[model samples]
Target: MFSNEEMRDMVCVYSTENFNGRRAHRIYLEMYPNRRQPDFKIFKNLYDRLGETGSFHHKRDSAGRPKTLNSEQEEEILVRVAENPELSTRRISMETGVSKSTVWKTLNKEGLHPYHFTPVQNLLQTDFPARQDFAHFCRLQQNADPMFLNKVLFTDEATFTRRGVFNFRNKHAWDLENPHLVSERHFQHEFKIKVWCGLIDNYLLGPFELPPNLNGKLYLEFLQTQLPNYLDDLPL
Candidate 1:
């Protein structure tokens, strides 16, 4: 009864098998009545003794629908597809001894969906080999001024989610939103965010927010906040 194949067979054959096999076993034990699977074993005795006695009643779930096969079959189909992408579900069911309908339901339920993933393309970041040359340039600067330039420190700030200035460039309307009306007065959005930083001969600086209205006034105030912290943390 504990074995999966037997349990599946039990559930397949008996409408109430699931409750009796797993859950009712516990309840029956606690009732101070019968021991072991005697409650289940009574099915045969009662069939012989009563022989379709219209007296028997079952507490079935409402709507009286036939049981859909357990999720096990659906799960099997999912494993089959992942294990061998070449085998279509029908072919898999044929070979593995399960029904095509079961396989179909499995695919839909498990979302064995086929889709595509586009690789991101960044031209500037594409030149991974140029990393060596960049390091070489930094080394040359270090040799040029050993004491002072070697003291140069570098730091960076990274924000996980950032708002983009304009989102309309790449945005698409799922359904035509006024295919004719193009007005900036009724549109707004912020898309992706990014990391920013700066560096000099013997100093480094920020990826901090510049502010919504980044002008001389706002820039000066931001500088004021960063300058003192930078000075304190600056390596002598």
Candidate 2:
């Protein structure tokens, strides 16, 4: 439901940028910083529709009943979602005087989907410096040797237990793509088994199991003993 002027501006930017939706969106934001910016999919859809029909509007279905939602109503739905992405389709329908199906249809048409939030460990303030230092060290190593990353083994461990933790499936963040949203949960003392994995030089290493309570001693022992077993076949 963009105005003629706005649509024209979008078209100008999109064409100039070689039809890159993301670049067109950035230019649109620069042109109208104060306006509510539409998602990248909106720009692409508008451009495709214009190309197919020579019009900025959607063609009505001749065989079926009239559209449940008009262009203005669809835009209203999008605006409401942008304002509050957590809003459910039922709630949006109630506020916008449309059916839940229509609201869902509008959002689906715009390529919006519900993405669940990922569970992450809560970080302490003191951890920030270490994280930054590690990132800087990695960047320096990459600059020093082009193959440094390829030779380095990236390893991570995750704990699993019977105890029920946060249920991320119950909550969702609706968007055109994964927002990489995370909900921090403080560590809780529970019976758990840790699984470790590593990757280097296109080789996948160990789904090795470790005791629930890990310490520097146990970790060093694993590196000095068990780690060698896996590295025997590696070029390292």
Candidate 3:
């Protein structure tokens, strides 16, 4: 029937055996405004025992990111990743209900090189093997089967563009931006390209050019004239 606000005692209690005179309206806040909830209940202990609740809140540090991954969680992630080869690490994490970071740390610690693919490595110590080269129907065919590779003439074409020369990397190298590397640098400026046409057996064909500026007649004539010289008279 009475609200929390209206519950304040309208008149203060002054124990009197015989009630007399006008009752005083309590003005002191020491007397709770809402008798419904007094200081004793709102906050616990002595500051409140003295009838004062003090400040409602205090300042604290902001939330922070966790410092490190737990070992067991990482192991679980590694096991799941190994079992499901079709699934990526992120996908494996979702399936196993473990964190992706744990999976990465586990993989790294296990010496797994996610980028490299070599069956010999077993991804180093990682549960997943680096690669498993499956033999399909095409791979089983004579042309692809290693035992019969010598007999089949695997032919291919090569064209020369005489403008770009390929370069092999040096035995030792450093980052281009490093001061030590920059001071000991060497730059190449060569323009000599030569392509070779060949059978996989190392029998190479010519690196001939098309006419300097092609014309239909010249192209056809070159084919007719050069075809004989290049192909040589076979048992035709």
* Ten-residue stretch with the least lDDT total in model 3: 12-21
lDDT of 2 by residue, 1-236 (tens): 46777777778888888999899989889988977677765676677778888987654343433347765567667866875788988788667777788787888988899776777989999999999999999999999998889988899988887554665656788999999997755557646789999999889988899867899999999999999898897766
TM-score for predicted model 2 compared with the true structure: 0.53
lDDT per residue, candidate 3, 178-230, as tens digits? 45532323346433333323343444445565555556798579667875576
Q: What's the TM-score of every candidate structure?
A: 0.22, 0.53, 0.30
The parts of candidate 2 lying over 4 Å away from their true place are 1-28, 31-67, 70-72, 115-129, 160-192, 228-235
Q: Which model, 2 or 3, shows the larger lDDT?
A: 2
Error of 3 at 108 (Å): 3.1
lDDT of 1 by residue, 1-236 (tens): 12334333333333344434344434444543332232243333233323444322222233422225443333334544654566775686665466666666656765556554566756676587697798887788767867645455554544443342355756655554657645353336543443446565556665655455455786577557775686576555
Cα RMSD for predicted model 2: 11.1
Worst 10 residues of 2 by lDDT: 58-67
Q: By lDDT, who's the top model here?
A: 2
Candidate topping TM-score: 2
Candidate 1 Cα misplacement greater than 4 A, ranges: 1-130, 141-150, 161-207, 212-235
List the pairs of residues colliding in candidate 2. Answer: none
**Residue-level error in angstroms, candidate 2, position 135:** 3.1
Scored by CA lDDT, what does every candidate get?
0.49, 0.79, 0.41
